[model samples]
Target chain A: MINRRDFMKLSAVGGGAVFLSGLSQITQAAAAYDDFYFVQLSDSHWGYQGPANPEANNTLRKAVETVNGLELQPDFIMFTGDLTHTTDDPKERRKRLTEFRDIVSDLKVKNVHFIPGEHDASLDNGAAFKEFFGETHYSFDHKGVHFVTLDNVSDPGASIGEAQLAWLAADLAKQARDARIVVFTHRPLFDLVPKWDWATRDGAKVVQILMEYPNVTVFYGHIHQENHHMTGHIAHHSAKSLVFPLPAPGSQDKRTPLPWNPAAPFSGLGFREVEAEDKPFQLKITEFPVTRA
Target chain B: MDLQISKGWKIGTACLAILALVSIGAAHSAAPKTGKERVVKVVAKRFIYTPNEIILKAGVPARLEFTSLDFVHGFKVPDLDIRVDLPPGKVTTVHLTPQKAGVYDFLCDNFCGVGHEEMSGKIIVKD
Candidate 1:
């Protein structure tokens, strides 16, 4: 059953007919499903040093602490992208990645999935990301849900491209129409704002492939703010960055990082928890602030 | 005899004037200001460069003043060996004179983020 809090949150975000339909399906499938949960951490931006986030160093540590403290253990953890701040030197990049890996290794969950943010993959065109995280784009199945992680950021031009698109099409062909699909990528597939560099160059093509599926949800990072959008029946949700926040689209003249306030540490930064159930298929998302203001 | 001498003098004077004018023309052609240094203000953010596409006359000198709106970014035009490191909130200037008319690609050599590789622009030099 849909709770009032979930309804309020969904309504506030303009969760349209598709979301409502999904909710109804979940309600009907309640008896046939087993519950499981996962955590999503995005834009940790490790190795980032600046006043924008005074606690930048501790940001990932704090997220780890929070995840460990969860009363209900998460089945896994997925980091959306922007794992590091980015550096030109190869040695430095490796160092940052190693440090980030070491820190996140402490996570209680063993099944952790990582996708490269532009900062991590754009420099060497996914070489570093692949070296460290294995495949840049791949799929996995967990509890009846098919999760597809794509490498959009590695292209430098921010495109899923032909090969990856073909892979996606072929991969989707194997799944039944009733299968629940969750897509993960670094950038928004639709144009959020071209001027602000929020839109992926060839994202429309990727969307076309995803449209064939009835139950498809896309989660992405890069905008560094919690946002929701819809294309056809598909719902797109952008998670908040673990490090710091950026200005809302066109909120300012420029898409600069939001200045941090010393008075309020880790105010607008946090991670998301997603609870999923089988049978009718239900996924409920909850966002937690790092520090309560 | 007097008329012939005057004619010769007149010709010599005219030749000297012609030489003076030719030298001045040569000097003007040699120092023709291609166009006042084309100054462009570029703001570098996470993974993209603003004013990414730059157009300049072939012979014109260009000055790009780059300021990072976000992180530290490196502006590099390898063809011209023009590179500048842009630190947040600081303006870095790069000077270039396009000697040839061609399209030159510039990119952020410093990795800014996931989009850094795609963070590039074209410098179109027109004759």
Candidate 2:
């Protein structure tokens, strides 16, 4: 049965929302392109070594290759988090950041924004992540659009908390009502399901802050597989992994973090690119395969 | 399908994949002993599980040699209902025996983030 959320998602994509779908659709702007394009690369579990994601088996190495291959230069790059894996280990954590740094070092692009998923912050509530990366939740402006990168995960109980909400309200308040806004995070701001590590605890507060914005889009990583849902004018999207794919949300009882299938090499690992035109920017998504060189 | 688990794997791993914080608090009452009977070693890294799917019979014990090359990860089988954390650089192992005949899904329960949800495979049990 087609669910309402699925239906909304269908409307977003099939209902004619994605400006361009792939590399083949690249076209020159006729008039002033208010459309600014950006790349969203999620779930790149660097440091994970397995046959499933051998292309990124070295973590740092594959990311460089993937980002370098963007057909067109994006306005910026947003990695929604999961910068590392696990806790209780410093060497591995350092390896994760070091590799991330290595990839960033080789990058010829500018302004790469990041957010922490539950994993990177899981060990010590993202103390390690803060040490390496900057603030967990922050917002910025690009062109005529407002971009909010939130910290919805990294807590023990999956709560968005209070401090971040205060920051969000102040940030969004600074933007014009007609200005376009895009919020990026690792976890969904809406409740997909609380019991299964989906929904955000204080996600509602974040939503309230964005309610004033006419054009709002929420992009999240985590969940692995592709998922999209829209509430009011807010659209939530989850990107595919550069590693493996998981079952739909709430599919099993802690029965996820599924393994990779050699038969399905780079099956679910892909990328999402969005171009915004007319200030807010027109968006596009391309699912490029993981190159295993 | 919805993404909830009553919770479960075959093989494979990820970089920022699964944050496997194994809180196996209260003894693993059934922690299989490292015995000399039947043991199987599994190499988990990247995202693909070697030997894709495995068919095992009941009463047969198998040891998993899981190793995480990139970061840390977890190995879980739903029908079998077992979870083991595979930290980077270490060859971790676990033992299990299939109790029924069916296709079971194994997933990374550690929320390795992003691809963490989809990082999984399957286990087939044959009578």
Q: What is the DockQ of each candidate?
A: 0.10, 0.06
C-alpha displacement of A268 in model 2, angstroms? 0.7
The estimated TM-scores of all candidates read 0.68, 0.61
User: What does candidate 2's lDDT look like per residue over A1-293, in tens digits?
Assistant: 76323333443442133533211222332232244567787877777665555656544455557667644456788888876654447677777877776677676577788788777786567777887778888888776667888887766445677877787888877765655677899888886754354667568888888877766788888777678787776778888776667777777645355666667666666666666644223445544445533
Report the lDDT tens digits of candidate 1 across residue range B76-123.
554554444576864565545566677666667554654554677878
* lDDT for each residue of candidate 1 in A1-293, tens digit (9 for 90 to 100): 86434443653243211222242233333123356767788999999988889889898898888777765568889999989888888888999999999999999898999999888888688888788889999999876678999888887567678999999999999987656788999899997865456777678999998888778888888898888888988878888898889989768545668899788778778878776745446666777765422
DockQ of 2: 0.06
Off by over 4 Å in 1: A1-33, A278-280, A291-293, B1-127
CA shift at A265, candidate 2, in angstroms?
1.8
User: TM-score (0 to 1) of chain B, per candidate?
Assistant: 0.69, 0.61
RMSD (Cα, Å) of candidate 2?
12.9
Which lDDT value does model 1 have at A187?
90
lDDT minimum window of 10 residues, candidate 2 chain B: B17-26
Off by over 4 Å in 2: A1-33, A50-60, A252-255, A279-281, B1-127
